[model samples]
Target: MLVSIELVPRSKEDLLRDITIVENILPQINVLNVPDLLRFDLRSYEAASFAYSEKKDFNVIPHIRAIDIAPDAPLPCVDRPEIKEVLVVAGDPPPTEQHEVYPNTSVDIIKRYQKEAPHLRVYAVFDPYRRSPKEELEELERKKEAGASGFFTQPIFDTNLLQLSMDWLRDETVFWGISPVLGEKSRRYWERVNNIVFPKEYDFSLEGNIHFAQRMLQLVKQQNDNAYLMPLRVDLGAYLTELQSFIVY
Candidate 1:
């Protein structure tokens, strides 16, 4: 399986530091939700520079959030010519003092990218657990029609849920699954940072989460022969080693 890490770089220095860390761990790394609240700058020049630097040393894939695909937005080809593919997500809007920015839908961005950058393959993000099987399949079809070349799913803990969604969609497009590892404290931090509201009795821990990830990975490999594991927010080297032992890559 090809392993990759996602980084949210808040500044140029942060971007550089992320690149260095990524190079030491995975052979390829993707910058997720770029130009969004975390990165904030998605101009072609800036993206190209980051892409160039990342490509010079490591395999870096630049991401394009849905909000960045404005009708009048310029192409990134001018600056970073090496960026051949982009992960298009309905990015969160600018956060307010009290709340986080909700992402606009991704269909518009997929359409815009198809019209503007024909050579760049677009990837659309989907959360299977967030919707019913029918709804998930419907969204995937919509995105495919809008010119998305592939689909990436949110972090999933339940394999049965994933299988049901995949069975319903029956799509030929590439599907990337995310598995995030967060300790108890980190999970709480993420919830607060993203303003995620959960049940009052919910509990989040690294041990339980990693166990869930392993189970999901097992089922995914058992059901889909072509599925590749994509571990997020953790050490790639360690995850890869564990996956190598578990999955028949």
Candidate 2:
């Protein structure tokens, strides 16, 4: 199984913590994903990634949103030799009512990005937690046809969701997204920001959330070998000790 960690550092303090977290988890995992979302600073993401790279022999994959990328503009991370893979996402639009660079769906981004840098393996976003599985799978099919190298899923809170849709996952190279929701504070944040509603049966306690994701990881790796842990601005250090103990390979 390929286990990887993802870090999102919005400021210098977070960047320092990201470095410490990576350093603390040294030799535990090599692959780390740094996605560019929210404020959109490619240089900061690169700098943080470079810091992590200096500490560990890690294959740090930085994410670039398609809308932020201009038409026929230079590919920043893709052209760089250190970054072999890039996660291309049709990220959420800016918080304001009006924004520059109108949104392009991930499929649209993939086609244009592949043309721009065919050598860089592009992993498109995959979240099957939608209301319609058929529609989601069909959208994934469109991405598959567009020459996306792999898929990155949203956090899997309900394992039954994946269990019911084995066929949807078996075909692609997936970096399974798993994260610990600390408590109601985190839950409400996800709800307010990302529209992720906590189910009535959802466990909101800190230990419960971590164990939930850990069990989900075991179940997922039974079928797929790749698991990606994304601590979306959450403190990853808290989850590291327990997660490292649970993962066998």
Highest lDDT, which number?
2
Best by TM-score: 2
Candidate 1 lDDT, 1-249, residue by residue in tens:
333345454576766665565555543434332333443544433544675665564434455656544455574442346666677766665455444333447887777668877888777777665557578678878989999877666654445556765675455554446455465666565455543334343334544555655666666566552333444566655655554444444
Any runs in candidate 1 off by more than 4 Å, and if so which?
Answer: 20-22, 27-35, 39-51, 57-59, 75-79, 96-104, 181-203, 222-249
What is the model-wide C-alpha lDDT for candidate 1?
0.56
Per residue, candidate 2 scores C-alpha lDDT tens digits across 90-156 of: 7667666555664567787788767877887888877765547788888888988887878888777
Question: How many residue pairs clash (N, CA or C atoms closer than 3 angstroms) in each of the candidate models, in the order given?
Answer: 1, 0
| TM-score on alpha carbons, each prediction | 0.69, 0.86
